[model samples]
Target: MLARLTIFVLILMLLAIGWKAWAYRKSALSALRKVEVISERFTRTDFFEEDNRRWIDSGERPDVVFMGASITSRWNPEGKLGDLAVAQRGVGGQWPSHYLLRFRSDVVDLHPRAVVFKACAITFRPGVNDKGTRRAILDLTAEAEEAGIKPVLATCVPVREDGNTVYGSDGKKLPDGINDRMLPFNDWLRTLAAERGYPVIDFYRAMADDRGFLPADLAVDDIHPNDRGYEVMTATAKPILETLLGAGRG
Candidate 1:
């Protein structure tokens, strides 16, 4: 009777161990699935399909189409840019490559006279493919030119300093090196615009503090802009856009 009781206790311990292992595996798999979802976000090319379709069905072409990732998504340029008809085609959490994928459908197909191209600040994060980002932007500019759409390049807005760290859209803390990279990237954008002979919106200059960081008053977070920030951006973009659209007719 004593031996049998000992065996029963051992069996129960074994069962508990097995159950704990299974639970841990299940939890790890759930976390992996979430990561997979994030990895596949760049492939979401159809994000604006229905919106594009609706605009096409309306038989009205916009004067300008603002295309970019989250920052542009939050920007409401309609009725804010004077009398020009505007359409916002900004998709959140997209890379420049993803922008190229939908450029034709969203920008060229919409038949806008001008298109504003702004890349997300996240594209400059560490370990991302910066070369691919550059290629995609160039391709977008070339495509727009071929289709007779004026392409205006805008600099990525500066990220804000949060305490001792800078946080990104993913809620992860970004390295200080990201700011180091962004300045050069924006400089490259300005050079590209000059070489290509198109207008460039200097959002960085318009919103950056004396130290080159986005001040708290204009920032929604590390990378996004608040209403006041957007107002600053709009004020910066207004003259450049007016000049570009006016030049096309002139």
Candidate 2:
């Protein structure tokens, strides 16, 4: 009788585990589908190979190309990065994984001499799955190297949110660990860029206010930066962008 009971319990446990896994998979798929729907409206399909095709076909290779989420798209590259030939392809609410998948088409195909990676602050928050930002960066860099295009990484900007959102509803906030995780991630990126001989721009430190939080004015929303914030980013990035443009290729 005890053996039968033990067998029944084991089966029940397995069933429970299977159900939970199925539910999680369903939720992840739902989120990914939403991302695709949004990407269609925002991303450039021929961004890499066929981007600025007219210009490239005319034998005009762009000096630089910037890719990321909203930060890259919304910012006026002309005003921000200078009057160089640049193609901006930023989709809001994107993670590194999405960027990796699109890199070949969006960035690599463009035949740009250099690629600028502007990481959005939202990516540092929770709800993003897989191995997190580090894995995303590593994959992106690897892919870029294989294509013979150098990647310039930037740190994730600050957010007003104290931490990540708690899962489910109790209206209670869980230990999101966003800020805590972000600092180390930025540090790691800086070190990684140095080790790989890639240039890293440190915007996280530049964007901080006296209180060590992203100023409310710089961002109309807690996550997205406003024009003022973009202005700051552009001003800060001008020197490096110009230097890179002038340096030319190896």
Give the TM-score of each candidate. Answer: 0.77, 0.72
Model 2, 190-221: lDDT tens digits are 89988998887777887877755678878877
Candidate 1: residue pairs that collide: none
Q: Which candidate leads in lDDT? A: 1
lDDT by residue (tens digit), candidate 1, 1-250:
9999999999999999999999999999999998777655655656778988988999888888898889998999776677777888888877788888778888898899999999877777655677888888899999999999999999988888652254667887666555677788899899999998989999989988998888999987877999999999988988888776752322
Candidate 1: misplaced stretches above 4 Å?
1-41, 163-176, 247-250
| Reference-based lDDT, residue 215, model 1 | 95
Worst 10 residues of 1 by lDDT: 241-250
